[model samples]
Target: MELRRRYHAKAQPGQRLPDDVWTTDALGVLSSGSKRDRVNAELFRAIAAYRQVVAKFKMGDMAGNALHRIGVIYTEYLKDPDKGFQAYQELLAHYPGTKEAVNALYKVGAYYLEKKQFAQAVKSYRQFVYNYPNDKRVQDGMLAVARCHMETKAYDKALDAYQSYLSKHPDGKHAAFAKAQVAWIRTYHY
Candidate 1:
């Protein structure tokens, strides 16, 4: 009862608190001079609460934005790659048609690339290309697919992807880079 009162009292007019605020505030409390055990307990509780929210909600861009924030926070601050990947994947699955989805797909692909998950990177980049064919990033996605294939030692597939990009976009902004990559790959093959 006291906790609810304190929480509600802090609410400003016309500003509704997000459900996660409870867990966040609890963490703040635990971190502020609380015992180590208390802090750990609060952290576990927060994780469980967040997981429940993630599971229960049918996410849109709003939730996707939240998930993106969670992913970045976990990846950068918490150093939890698995949780971060899960958050990103949730954004992709729940908000596939949103602007956030396009951005998330790119981010997930980049994440896979950084982790040297070349096949996963290609899969993500391909999906991005298929979904946003006319987007400015479409060319970049195509280029990334080729780069991922190249990194995974699939030289022929990389050449095909790069060649396709060059042919489709002769004067594109990334055309020179695509052509250069194709030339480099061809030289290596020869």
Candidate 2:
């Protein structure tokens, strides 16, 4: 109750809770001045309250930002790819037009690639390329799509994607790399 009061006091009238106070260090504060059991209880209560506030918000850039943060924490701090994937997936689903969506798409593709899930990586990169065709990262996404097919032993598909990218972006940042890959793929076929 006291924590809730403090949280509400800091919140602007009709505004959502500020993002800063949810930091792990601040969350640690709930343990101070309490016994082990009491501290755990208070800490969990605070976490639950914060989650409730987070849930009340609409899906968009803000949600994407939160999901990205969660993803990073899970991926880097917790060393939990499954949880991280869920966060990335949520960001992609909720904010497909936001910068976070682009990043989420890249992360999802990379995650699948690392897991050797080449088909899933190809699907993700394809979606990214289609959605953000004009983005500077489009070239990289194109390359990723080709790489996914290559990793999956689909040499023809890899060659086709790379050729398409070269046709559209002859002078792209990845152009030389794509051409090299095309030559490499041709050697396998011939």
Which pairs of residues have clashing backbones in candidate 1?
none
lDDT of 2 at 4: 53
Off by over 4 Å in 2: 1-53, 59-61
Taking the tens digit of each residue's C-alpha lDDT, what string does model 1 give over 96-184? 77676777788789889989999999999999998888888888899999999888888999999999898888898999888888889
Which 10-residue window in model 2 sums to the lowest lDDT? 31-40
Best TM-score among the predictions, by candidate number: 2
TM-score of 1: 0.67
Cα RMSD of predicted structure 2: 8.5
Q: Model 2, residue 87: what's the lDDT?
A: 78
